[model samples]
Target: MDMAQRETWTSRVGFIFAAVGSAVGLGNIWSFPFQTASNGGAAFLVVYLLAVFLIGFPTMLIEFVIGRRSKQNAVSAFSELGYGNWTFAGVIGVFASFITLSFYSVVGGWVLNYIVGSVTGGYLGDASTFFGSVSSGTVAVAAHAVFMAITIAIVAGGVADGIERATKFMIPAILVLLAGLAVWGSTLSGASAGYAYYLSPDFGVIATNFTSIVPSAMGQAFFTLSLGFGVMVAYASYLGRDDSLPGDSAIIVVLNTIVALLAGFAVFPILAATDALTGSTGAGTAFVALAGAFGQLPAGRIIGFVFFVVLLFAALSSSISLLEAPASYVVDSYDTERWKVAVGVGVVAFLLGIVPAYGYVGLFNDFVFNILLPIAVLFIALFAGWIYGGEAVDELGRGTSLGRGAMTAWLWWVRVVVPIVVAYTLWLGVTNFYAGLVNGAYF
Candidate 1:
């Protein structure tokens, strides 16, 4: 916990790779493709790009400022940055990271299950039923616990030995597998339909629902990038030098965006070919459709194994980052034992995984995605926007010209637009929660 030395990145490459690893999770591959298709095709992409540029960048700057300025984890970083009252923002951040990884472990568990099944050639038989059982009930819970355990083990190792070392391999492996899948999927007969559904923007469809799409775009923008969580601030706080935050930020964004685009190449073709493109394309879409494709295709089991392995890497990378936010918080704040915080969080995450393993699965997903996530992010934006003020902007543009020119305007946008959108999303999350529960609305 003696981060007083100011953590330096093992390399600039390591820094970019770690950030990209954080950004390119199930959010990009599992959620983005279907969410885009379900929302309004290319229109969703357009809105998403705008969100990334207008809000995501500034918010990232904000987190970087807080992290670098305090040179501490979320808790200490927030309290150290400004007035005592503003420290609440730090608390909210640590809590958000905690909540995020809780259910995420459940999904991570599902990925692990698929990985095992792929090795066993389970997908060679019945894809639908196999993926179905994996999605719900007690089996899913067990898998989640296992995933959390793996995540905790990595986080316990601390920065250099744990998170950095793991990402070095996982990120490259993930990229390789995803590339292979995208290439294979392109050879399918229905790949064109999938590509059309993915890339062809329908303005008419978008025009009909601009209001809803704007908010969806904004939320996806922030959440997908993992900005405003104090997670980035936590990571940046470890830095010893203020290299090119602008160039670094842009590299992370492009890597994440390309991965998301490649995900469509990997997912949509299989879905269209298998004829599983149905319903609202919920969180379960990737789990169902891809598993189905793996079952039916020749050499299906091996492909399934590759998919799940890639997924496991994605989940682990992200889950590690999520745990790091909170564990770092505890380590920095009380000078508590780092291993104690890591073990403590892992145990809690293990228990929390149960919520999504049973009847409350949908509720667990909605609660985190809808409630805690947006609220935590909202406070993060507010802190960076009003409390940390211009310092956040200066943190980004410290040693570069692009940083200097863009930092002021970016700060202005974060101060003006970002918090307002976060607040609105928080409200929407509440409404969605009630509707999903009382009204029995399909989430």
Candidate 2:
């Protein structure tokens, strides 16, 4: 854990791939499509895209600036920058990462289940029933543990050897498989309706449902990009002074967005073709509706296998980043060996994940995504814009081609825009959660 011995990304491309790997995961493939479907399709898509640029991008730059400036884990990074009081923000980030991964690993387990089910046709007949059976029983618990174990093994390998190497391979494989699925999906009989739903916004829906739509859109935007939780901060800590934060951030955002769009193209078309679009509204959309679509396709067994494999890769790529956020905190703080800390974190996460594996996924997901995530982001925005302020701009500008004007603009956005927008969204989320509680709906 010596400063000089700390592992840096071997190359810029390697670092970008790893960052994109973290960004483009179940958040995109699983959550994005479902959130879009439930939140007014293209209306949600439009708001989500705006949130990505307006909020997510600026907040991501804040994380990178903090990480690269401190060269420490998220929690210690503030203290390293002589702002120890703001370490509370970093603590929220660490907690978010830990809690996010607990339920996240459970979904990774679902992907694993489908990968095998694809081959055995286990989910072919009644996709909903199959999902119910596998989603919450002892089988789900075992799969969650297995997924966490894989994540721990990769993270134990250290940054360059484990995360960078795995992502270098996994990201390309995910893109290729997803692209192929999109192409095939385009040929489905009712694909145009899917395309319309995904791409054509209904302004009336947005006007009528603005309150509900914005919160979900903003949350999805942050979730898909791995924002709010310091995953990016931990990743950026490994960056060298010569790496361009602006360039890297842009590339990561663009690539991640493209992959998300491709997933929509791949998913919605299939659902439309199979008349299963109505079912694409919950956590089980991919496992149930999409799996059902696959069951009805030509050569479905092979296609289904490939699709699940892609999902598995996406899940691992992001899950490692999530695990690494807290694992890096422990490694940086306690000087524990990376492998030992990785195992410890993995074990605890697996144990804590049992609730979600037992079918409390919606509760956990609501708490983490809607509530915890926005609060974390709000803290980050305040620190970057207020506490860190000028120093953050200097840090962002250090290794990048961004001029003073651009950096200033970014700083102001973080200071004014991000805080206001995130606060409003946080209010919405809290209100919704309270309403759900009063109505006994979340259970």
Candidate 3:
């Protein structure tokens, strides 16, 4: 099929849901609150919002332009937009997506396990033991296969029938579920403390932790938006050029932020009310601490069921995007059928995921999130700001209402500010990884 004959999003709303589906994933729910909590709570949220609007928003628009203008997948989009070797950025993006899904599906599998366990009372005992049991061996592999199959099924359905349709329902379902959870959680006795902890700014802490916290906030901003890995480019590739890149970006950003904040509100209150370890973060926070909270909360079983269902949907929403990045690239760059591309890439990603699922989870997480992703993002920024340059701005401004001043500001942010901040974050991640390696501290 000719690139020009490719399927497009049926409507602007579908496109927005698809994009929001990509951005609102495990990171938004499981990761964002932890990052905020560890980095000075409300203070970190302020910085993260700044990074989102100033850095993430413009960069996202650039990706949208790259995809819609080219009407191609990530690798092909770059080749269509720029000169030779620019496609290498797309290659990196594709590779990063594969690595991301490998571990991502492992976590997705865990979510599936928890969903089943919540109903059957399987995780009602020691959270650590349950997590340990679920994270490896035959159980992990089986769960991962199930998760990947679901992701592949969606990707195989093509654009309108699959990605967009699924997200249109799933995103709204998540909002409703989280909203209900938040409202219920607010009635808990200690909910006020949770809100205070999440929203109160400690200026002294922010000042003292400024240097360390900025990287976290920036990383969260980038990751929460699902940038740096060609996911957005692939999603945007299906968009009609008439779509407003800036407006769509705003909608996606707002949806992602709200979901993240809602997750924090819902989880933190339950944690506070139950006296689950408020200091914890990451997988443990989501799995263990949150599971413990569910056991103690009123209607605990029902709450656990709803929370894990939301978690599974959130993970699946993002996993499909991760799978799509490489699948779309293969279909576009190799002229393969979408189903074959999806199955082949998905099986390979599943096999690769087993290694992380068995063990080395932390190592894989660090290498991908802290290193490969940031590097991919940096290249994207440089490619758009320097290589694509004026053409990129023209694409962004096309069929949109962005004035010259807005375009100029967006250009400057993408070209100058994004690269510099991303570079610093990448550097910090590299240094930290190395330091952990030397001290035998990294997993």
lDDT value for model 3: 0.84
**Ten-residue segment with the worst summed lDDT in candidate 3?**
276-285
TM-score of each: 0.93, 0.98, 0.96
lDDT tens digits, residue span 1-443, model 3: 58666888899999899889889998888778777766777888888888888788888887887888888878888667656588888788888888989988988998999988898887877777888889888899999999999999999998899898999999999999999999999999999988998888787887898766776777777777888788899888887777788889999999898998899899778877877525735545578777777777678878899999998889988998999999888888778889899999999999999898887566776677668777888888898888888888888887788798888777777889888988988888887778768987645
Residues 171-249 of candidate 1 have per-residue lDDT tens digits of: 8888888999999999988888888877778888778976567656666666668764567877887665657777778
Better of 2 and 3 by TM-score: 2
- Report how far residue 291 has shifted in candidate 2, in Å: 1.3
Q: Which candidate leads the pack in lDDT? A: 2
lDDT of 3 at 288: 78
Model 1 worst lDDT window (10 residues): 1-10
1 or 3, greater by lDDT: 3
Evaluation by TM-score, superior candidate among 1 and 3: 3
RMSD of 3: 1.5
lDDT of 1 at 259: 81
Choose the strongest candidate by TM-score.
Answer: 2
lDDT-best of 2 and 3: 2
- 204-263 in candidate 2: lDDT tens per residue? 999999888888888888888998788999999999998888889999999999999999
Better of 1 and 2 by TM-score: 2
Question: Which candidate order results from sorting by lDDT in descending order?
Answer: 2, 3, 1
